[model samples]
Target: MLENEFVTFSQNFLDRSGNHRSNQKKINEYLCKNSAQYLIYWRGKVPVVSDVRDQLCWVGRDHPLVLNYSGMPTFLGLENDIPFFSINISSWLPGNYNEAAAGAFFDSNIYNHPDLPESSFFAELRGFMNRISAREAELAVMTRGINVWQENNLYCSKCGNLTEIINAGWQRNCVNCGAFHFPRTDPVVIMLVTHGNNILLGRSHGWPDKMYSCLAGFMEPGESIEAAVQREVLEETSILVKNVRYLTSQPWPFPSSLMIGCVAEALSKKVLIDPKEIENALWVSREEMLEAFSGNNERIYPARVGSIAHFMIKKWLSGSIE
Candidate 1:
């Protein structure tokens, strides 16, 4: 396990200017006066280097990769005096240019950050999560999730009228019906279920070959964290969990999910995986998990280093989880 490692979005370096979100006049004045930069997320394909390391590379507002916007860009709060903004471009930008990074992750548009000219400076942020600094990763995650919400909730949920960005880029307001909306973060419980020296690991159907990690599920309404942890394990793996406690959390913004990490004790060892929920589920000895972490295990590999699953298991292996 890597030492001194911070979860991707847990860094506190960026000072999100909360006061300026409501003060439109002041924010507008700052935007007009200060030399600000943008975190330009085109569709969700964040910019990164083409190297195997896949370093993060956030393009500036004036970069050739960015085209002129048609209207007010979704303004992300400020970091110091430097203002941050994001904009969504039309699909036409990728239709004319033909290099393929379009749509970033979910679509082919990632290939088209206004057309990344087959160079090392531009690539999609698919594998760059571990390669980049935690600070930048946090910024990218925040920038992407907010914009995706804005896109999905363009119209007010209450009324059909289009909503306008109200609290900076954090929220939207419907002029037609006076309704307000904000970016949402869905809570997910990711727990390391342990019994003696072994930890529970489950793999989803489409994961890479031999990859496994902790059991997790979305937190349903009215469910306490402990109850969700216990219920998720029982439903998916047929393992009852007890002594649930918070360990850590990671912002899993593949759209927007807050992965609340926890540690739980298993009451029943007999494994019966719901094939519909998990492809395979079993208990992995801590020694085997350690081996998997170090690339010595042939049967399975550890979770990606930046993920909450990796952090929790690594902490448990290092005797840090209590």
Candidate 2:
């Protein structure tokens, strides 16, 4: 995939992450010196925008800010001279000065209001991702994922005991059963399954009408990425896929997920739509896909740019998926 070259923290959580000690010290110096770092806080899937940091403060959701990193400050070890971890706050920018300020900061539905700078935060971030050093974006993604995972997994799954942040917020220790839990990355298979010159795609019920992308689903307990691709295709659209091949992946931190993109050859073209999982499914031909990409196809739309689905499909159109 052409987008494979983008910098991502695929190895950030690996065993050798300890090598980042020196790097953390440096990043910490920068963050602490600044008035406040750009923080991404979420209320469910919607992110709360801090329109003005001048009047903003973070109150820990329950407890005061701690260095544990589990609730938000779990030290993410170190990265050179920078120390990066997560931070959690109950709410953000409590008193609103202007409703227009909301959309100017973050483009979220809950925080969306008119009168603010009219710029979508996600769009701005996407522009930054496309231009800035990939390392910066990678760091931002990693930081958000770490913070979200720690905030949600506060208790032990087995014994229902409260878990404490450990290993610099990378691991959680169960007080009752001595269980150590690590940050989790749920694997999702996103595949562009093709038959001849047509690619199979589907959309869920709540998605915008005619907005279809690659078929995707969570990996089963013991399923491999390739199996997930085939299984998801069959289950959702009854399209049997063969010759599955890996392409690339992206860390989607909307609650911590790793989207694994792949390309698969379709063995059967029959579409037995599974209404429970998808609102619609179809096989769009190469010409039609090109038209969709160019915004000329009115019946279907391509996946949003910057997404793994878009990356994979673009690769195919460029003859790189081979």
Candidate 2's residue-wise lDDT over 117-181, tens digit each? Answer: 23322123332334434554555566567777777888999898999875545778899999988
The regions of model 1 sitting more than 4 angstroms off are: 1-5, 50-55, 59-67, 90-126
Best by lDDT: 1
lDDT of 1 by residue, 136-181 (tens): 7777788778878888998988979988877667788998998878
Alpha-carbon lDDT, every model: 0.75, 0.64
RMSD of each predicted structure: 3.5, 6.8
TM-score of each: 0.87, 0.74
Q: Residue 116 error for model 1, in Å?
A: 6.6
